[model samples]
Target: METNHINQSPIDLESLISGLKTEDARNLKLMLNIQSMMWGIAAVYVFISALKFIMTTSWYDKLGGFLTLVAFVAFALLFRSYYKEYKTIDYGIPTIEMLKKAAIRYELFQWRGLYVLAPLLLEGIGLNLMMFDDFTNLEPLNRILFFQISYFFVMVIAFLVGYIIWKKRQKPLRDYALALLKEFQS
Candidate 1:
């Protein structure tokens, strides 16, 4: 009878305290860790390529490579900060505090995103400058259609992928955190 009464209770204490036990939170941590490692590897590769470009005889290559390095370094640092934020999640913290952290962490767009635009613009400009020599021999129209149009398509694809990831993964985790917070408050 006691067991049956307990089962009929309105709230389950176990469910409330299991912060990281939720599937969404666990998945979020795993995804962040994996992405952080992958971005670190990509940063290293870009560093090597940038060095090669800077070592070339072409003046354009040198300038473009320097710009690209600056932009990519910013991206790498941003990704590292995200990784560090997730790493700081401590189970021992108060549940409300932990949930608040998770909510902020999963936000799809934050002020930092605005700051990223400068680096993104720099990268685009740098890439175009780097390709100047290659595109020089092509007809002007062909160069625009081939290089510029293709770059636009690549950016679009990347944006769509990022949106999908946020919607499918990050948004749900955020929603979950909010829901848990609401439950706690009531």
Candidate 2:
């Protein structure tokens, strides 16, 4: 890139450092808030499911609520684990080396974050497996139709979320990191 007669001078080191720190702090707060909200939502679902399990007359709703309650609690645990970890990341220093190290560590954290989603994936599969009885009680045609329709919706939503994260989040983050860290790479 040409350096001469740019519209504006490059950002000062202090400004860059402060900007990065602010960004990290803001990101952490947002993450923690989201996790807390997820936990809250899961807890609410668990309560609702418990009420349904106790008060409902249908075998289907009872079993379904109990199973869903388990899944929501599992999700709450996942969020709690990551929330604790997010709470621990501190602003260390404003130096370039420290920032570079922080960036690398953040990348590792992102990978480790996959563990946070494992419970959801496992529960999703488990729910399907355990749902045989849920289907068996219903009429054959309705069972097959409903199951297929639910799975179709789930798969479409999964695909859309995956595509969105890859395109809007992952790619942009990778590009931003490469550009931002280029100066410190020696």
Candidate 3:
């Protein structure tokens, strides 16, 4: 009589880590795309708004508003995609989980800061334009002042959020990478 035995293979930690790295790279690319799209939209909006101000007409106002709305929608979609990706990770894979958590924290900071601060800054600019009677009355000095103030506010908020996320995730990311390296060596 002959007996049959079943064979089991060990978990391929290197392959697992490689896969995690690939996923992280993909997520980073997506994040960069989202950021680029946001900046592009913002630049276009600023240009349109400036043209409207210089022309001293409400004709472009509707188009500007529509573009702003589209940008907001695009941001919302990106946020949702980020949230979904963050939630779908397998925590059993400790290193991958840590990386995913770091990504989630970064994305959360970006979403909150950009969504809240950008609109507030834009509203301030719109209000300033409304208060000025005409483009000629909005002197170069006044326009520069408004632009600088709003830019400062947005930059400060973005920097603060970015710093917080970096500080919070640095240790975890390092530990995760080290752990993965150890696993690979063993």
What TM-score do all the candidates reach, one by one? 0.63, 0.49, 0.43
Better of 2 and 3 by lDDT: 2
Off by over 4 Å in 3: 1-57, 91-137, 140-145
lDDT of 2 by residue, 114-159 (tens): 7646555555544554464666778756765676578668867987
Better of 2 and 3 by TM-score: 2
Per-residue C-alpha lDDT of model 3 across residues 31-140, encoded as one tens digit per residue? 77866887777777777666665775664354445455554645556566666765565666776556545555544345555665555455445454454344556775
lDDT of 1 by residue, 1-186 (tens): 987887788988567658537866887787777777767766786777677765788876777777877887777777667667766679899999989988987898888778778888778777776787897889856864676677778888998999999999999999999999999999
* Best candidate (score: lDDT): 1
Deviation (Å) of 167 in candidate 3? 1.3
- Candidate 1 yields a Cα-based lDDT of 0.79
TM-score result, candidate 3: 0.43
User: Which residues of candidate 1, in runs, are more than 4 Å off?
Assistant: 1-58, 138-146
Question: Against the unseen true structure, what C-alpha lDDT does each candidate score?
Answer: 0.79, 0.65, 0.61
Candidate 2 residue 71 C-alpha distance from true site, Å: 2.6
**Better model by lDDT: candidate 1 vs candidate 3:** 1
Residue 144 in candidate 2, Cα distance off native in Å: 4.4
